[model samples]
Target: MSTPTDAAPAQPGVRKAGEDLLTVTDLHVYYGNIAAVKGVSLSVKQGEIVTLIGSNGAGKSTTLRTISGLLRPRTGTVVFDGKSLVGIPGHKVVGHGICQSPEGRRIFPKMTVEENLELGAFLRNDKAGIAADKERVLDLFPRLKERIAQKAGTMSGGEQQMLAVGRALMGSPKLLLLDEPSMGLAPVLVDLIFDTIRTIRDQGTTVLVVEQNALAALRIGDYAYVLESGHLKQEGVARELLKDDSIVKAYLGG
Candidate 1:
């Protein structure tokens, strides 16, 4: 019965968050009559690697979609760098420096990897900057560099995953939203993906990742939120949570 104007209160553990780059409060997203996300509030500070850890259908992807403006929240506020992002469209959200590498690796299947990366920066006009970002993406994922001219659909799952993250980087995002970056990858590939995520954060981009791999996600995250059936049931410093076996075992199934 609550309306969008009744914003949820900030989570307790977020007091130490430094200069929030993305803030979502009281976000309630629905698919038809079903409430998929219920009152989830979280923040991502500038330059931090924040992870959302939970089981499948726990509103992780839904939250990212709402933030990216692919799904509008019925009641909430999404603020990015002091600018309200509630009504912004998905494409404009990219222009505001937020890009998402969505779940299922939604790359242009028929397009070559290079072409897909170019589409990631379609909203921009900076030719030099776009070119530099493309190179940077290639450097981050050498596998992608090797197959730059290949059609995206022909790549292996891990290779396609690399292309997804690489293409998101081409958008020159300040905050990158990654939905299940390690999904369906080999153990080594998962490690590689997590390592690249850390590298991305270190390279001056804030990262908000939705990951089902609790242990790996906690290992790389500065802060983490545990989502359960659409509610944020737990949150704290990632290191502390990683050390708390009870928390991980009970909520995140690590």
Candidate 2:
């Protein structure tokens, strides 16, 4: 099981670049007695879109959940913006400027689109800012604006995915954690979703996404890490990895 520290040596210039906004050092997460993430380490620089790509049961979602405070790491640390996030409760994680659009598009089924978005800002009291953000989210997902009064469950999968991301943005996150944004979407919707991710990054929020769509994710990512069976197998510039024969063979279906 190679770790990021050792893996970096195999890929020169893969070390942390610029200013790191989020750093996970030797992270080890467990589900009951089984180790889900085994001594993984990675970093996301400010304003960059970093991705974690792997197959099923590779601990990709587990890493995001740990970073978002949904799961506790038995060892190692999660540092965001120079502050340690270890042991922080899940709900309070949002207040610290990290927000997650989880694996499944977990939008409020019974709530209208607008109401679901408002829930993202639950920790904030700045009414004006919240209102402004709502407009911004609507603008990002114009389809959402059209369905503002419609129930979230009634929307299509792509629309609900957009809503999930929009709701996370409404929280005004400094670092956005997106888990499997492209899962289960049609090819056209996948393109739209990945495009939207770039748009979000261009808008100035840093992103750390866990994705199963290796090709699409690597195409837009600044940097990427490969997780396999709870281990960090590779780490490098996304474009560089895209050209690697082994990576292409294993993850890109070449």
Q: What do the candidate models score in CA lDDT, each in turn? A: 0.89, 0.91
Q: Write the per-residue lDDT of candidate 1 for residues 105-159, one digit (tens) a residue.
A: 8999999999999999998899999999998999999989889899999999999
Residue 249, model 2: lDDT of 98
Off by over 4 Å in 1: 1-17, 251-254
Candidate 2 lDDT trough over 10 residues, lowest sum: 1-10
Cα shift from native, residue 199, model 2 (Å): 1.0
Which model scores highest in lDDT?
A: 2
Model 2 TM-score on a 0 to 1 scale: 0.94
TM-score against native, each model: 0.92, 0.94
**Superposed Cα deviation of residue 217, candidate 1 (Å):** 0.6
Candidate 2 displacement at residue 78 in angstroms: 0.4
lDDT of 2 by residue, 102-138 (tens): 9998999999998999999989999999999998898
Listed per candidate, the RMSD to the true structure in angstroms reads 7.3, 5.2
| Candidate 2 off by > 4 Å | 1-16
Question: Residue 165 lDDT in model 2?
Answer: 96
